[model samples]
Target: RKYGGAIETVLAHLQESEERLKNIETFEERKEELKKILAQQRENYLISAREIHDKRTKAARRFEKEVETNLKAVALEKARFEVRIDAPNAADLQSGNNRRLTAKGFNQIEFYFSANVGESPKPLARVASGGEASRLMLILKTTAKAGDAEKSVVFDEIDVGIGGRVAEAVGLKLKELARTQQVLCVTHQAQIASLADQHFLVEKETVGKKTRVSARDLNEKEKVEEIARMLTGAQITETARKHAKEMLGAAK
Candidate 1:
């Protein structure tokens, strides 16, 4: 009887051990399944991150290349060009997120230039000379028109720093650019203004106590008078008008 009882106890212990081993095996299988799911999710996240990075990098590079090419073509070939992409400030961020957002792909772009051939290019605000800044601004406007097919460009006092041949060059550039865009230039330089397809004059008139602004499109004869006025300041003479006519004819 004792031997039989000992056998029964041994059998019971063996069954208990088997049950525990089965439970452990089941837990390990579940754990392996969880690991596979986590790995898949991580792989998907990596792919998405790579795609975003590639897209952002490509857009930035394209914009940089276009601006650089345009700058070179607009007489700043030796000038260095740079693009700054700064994240939006805290005010621009979402309510709960630290990341800021901007309409221009989370960044803003500013153009910088250097006038001297060997000088390092700096921000547009850093350029101190009035003439250099005017020309730089003109070059940027001209470049923007060249890159687009459906845009119009206007130049107001763009020849402020240029004279002689440089003034003539400015005129030619304006004419060339006008072939692709509508160019309206308000200029004091007869050399520059004479190249316009159509010229309008802005004059101030006193109506009682208040001054009113008036503009008129000049006819051929009136255009001569206006050009003469520009040439001689407030004094228009017969000789000056004739000289203005000659300059206009030469420009054509």
Candidate 2:
């Protein structure tokens, strides 16, 4: 009876070993299946990212051309603008690939500009002047999808480093933009202020020892006089007023 009981115990141990081995095998199979599913998901993501990259490439080409044309309108006639989109380097790919993939897709974008003919295109930080930068920003805004017009867009002295025909162009562009959205522009140039549908003159007032700043909406006569003042500093000459009237009329 002792020998028989010992034999039963041995058989029990053998059965438990076999069961454990089967469980390990089942686990290995499940792990392989999970790996395959993960691989397929990664491949699908990569395919989608490549599709997005292609669409962005096509759009960038068109955007570059249109921005170059707009730059010409802003007096950078020789400027060449480029929208560069490129994939990450091989080193970045080897370091877990996740760094390259973003909500925007698996590519990087940088705006490049050549402000003058015969010059190589460089990043906007290195090449574009203040006026050129402003113009580029304005053009980008113009090209972007229209947003809620109730959102006011303010431009403070964007007309800096520009005057004459370029200033006129900027004013006209602002006016056009204002049709779809509200734009508030602070400019020393009479050209820009003249384009405003409503004009306000900012002044500083001193009462006793305290000085305060005030802005008042100008009437039509006041608007003309303000433009004349902008043209002739503290002096409002007849010629300046006449020129201001002509500018306002022409802007209309």
Candidate 2: segments with Cα more than 4 A from true spot? 1-29, 89-96, 145-150, 204-214, 249-252
Candidate of highest TM-score: 2
Residue-wise C-alpha lDDT for candidate 1, range 154-245, written one tens digit per residue: 56557665566667667776777777777767678877787778888998999999999999888999889888987888889989999999
RMSD of each: 14.5, 8.0
* Candidate No. with top lDDT: 2
Q: Candidate 1 at 136: error in angstroms?
A: 1.7
Task: Give me the runs in candidate 1 sitting further than 4 Å from their true place.
Answer: 1-109, 115-120, 125-133, 141-150
For model 1, which pairs clash?
Answer: none
lDDT (tens digit, per residue) of candidate 2 on 1-252: 443468888788789889999989799788999999987876787778889988999999998888878877777788888888989775765565687787777898998889888999999898867666767777777866464588888777578777887888888888878888888888888888888898888889999999999998988899899988888899789999999998887777
Q: Compute the lDDT of residue 19 as modeled in candidate 2.
A: 94
Give TM-scores for every candidate, taking all chains together and pairing residue i with residue i: 0.55, 0.74
What lDDT would candidate 2 get against the real structure?
Answer: 0.82
Query: How many pairs of residues collide in model 2?
Result: 0
